[model samples]
Target: MPIIVTPRHNSPEFKEKCVRLVLEEGRTVAEVAKEMQVGRNTLHGWVHQAKVMSEAVNRAVEAAVAEALRAEREESDARAAADRAEIVRLQAELATAREELAKLKGKG
Candidate 1:
């Protein structure tokens, strides 16, 4: 495949589009290359020099956020389980107390 030149290095639309492809598109590099109709090497160069660094940083941030969310959900689940266990324990204690009170009132 021949090399395809994108119009100018500073076109806003062009820069935004390339950034979108690398970051948010979720497509493979080759897929974006084909879709952009540019040579894969050229596009790779554009990405590497331009948006690739930011994209990689954004991915790290996203991963951190997801890990935190998962941990928070697990903690919430643990708290709910503890609450249920405490409720059961209190119910059992109440039942024992009621039985003792009945025996004291001459109820066998």
Candidate 2:
């Protein structure tokens, strides 16, 4: 009989599912490895790697959220400053109008 070999190229999604099966489903590494036709050590590595990657992703997401909040706060501050400046301009315009009206009434 001719020898046939199975390719060892497992996709990341497949590795994630296998890791989930072992971790989330509470299945033994050996059992999942046997069922999935993967080596026991390989599956264990996948599970450990998944945990490490999860922590890294969580940290990255937290940093991204913090940066976004900071940007939003800065934008809000800028808008508030602009609003205050506009209010001051409007108040000055109102005062000038009042002075002009007083002068006109005195002349009348």
Candidate 3:
């Protein structure tokens, strides 16, 4: 059996800095990889994460999106409920009117 060991990574801040440089600073992944002495695939993955990963600054943006979706769904549900209520009310009214018409015809 052979034992395997993984290389320890740089600090988070360093990783963040490099990722940000590759992503936000428009640095080429290959260039960053060469600078960091890491594989291009590794640098590309870091840059991709930097671009997509949600951060504290983006928390409000994500929350606003969730709230907007919830509000839109709530509005749709409320409209559907209102339509159902209106249908029931109209049906009951129709039944009552029919009964009254029958009573009037009997009196006539």
Candidate 4:
């Protein structure tokens, strides 16, 4: 006669904590799985899932940062354009004032 063993079901929170212990706490999957009395392969799968989720979050953050940088650059460009226009207007006004001064001096 052959003997068989039944598998045990663990809670989702328990699985997440075990995965965190291996991925975030710097513990080996085998070590944590042993401590938790689970199979090494099972813990590895959870760790893999966690890594995939983390990668997705990282990509989203990078995209958001890139968008913010682009928006800031656009705002800076608009400000620079406005400054240039103001400079041109001031130069024109200064030239008109100089011309008026020259006329007054000629009359005197």
On TM-score, the candidate that comes out on top is 4
- Candidate 3 TM-score versus the reference: 0.47
Clashes of 2: 0
TM-score of 4: 0.81
Candidate 4 residue-wise lDDT, 1-108, digit = tens: 222223342677888888889978999997897778777887898889889999999999999999999999999999999999999999999999999999999999
Structural similarity to truth (TM-score) of each candidate:
0.54, 0.77, 0.47, 0.81
Give the count of colliding residue pairs in each prediction: 0, 0, 0, 0
Q: Residue 41, candidate 3: how far off, in angstroms?
A: 21
Off by over 4 Å in 4: 1-12
Clashing pairs in 4: none
- lDDT to native, each model: 0.79, 0.87, 0.77, 0.86
Instruction: State the lDDT at 74 in candidate 2.
Output: 100
Worst 10 residues of 1 by lDDT: 1-10
lDDT of 1 at 36: 68
Ranking by lDDT: 2, 4, 1, 3
Q: List the residue pairs that clash in candidate 3.
A: none
**Model 1 over residues 28-99: C-alpha lDDT tens digits?**
768887876766776677777666677789999999999999999999999999999999999999999998
TM-score, candidate number 2: 0.77
lDDT of 2 by residue, 1-108 (tens): 322224542777778778989889999998998777788888899899988999999999999999999999999999999999999999999999999999999999
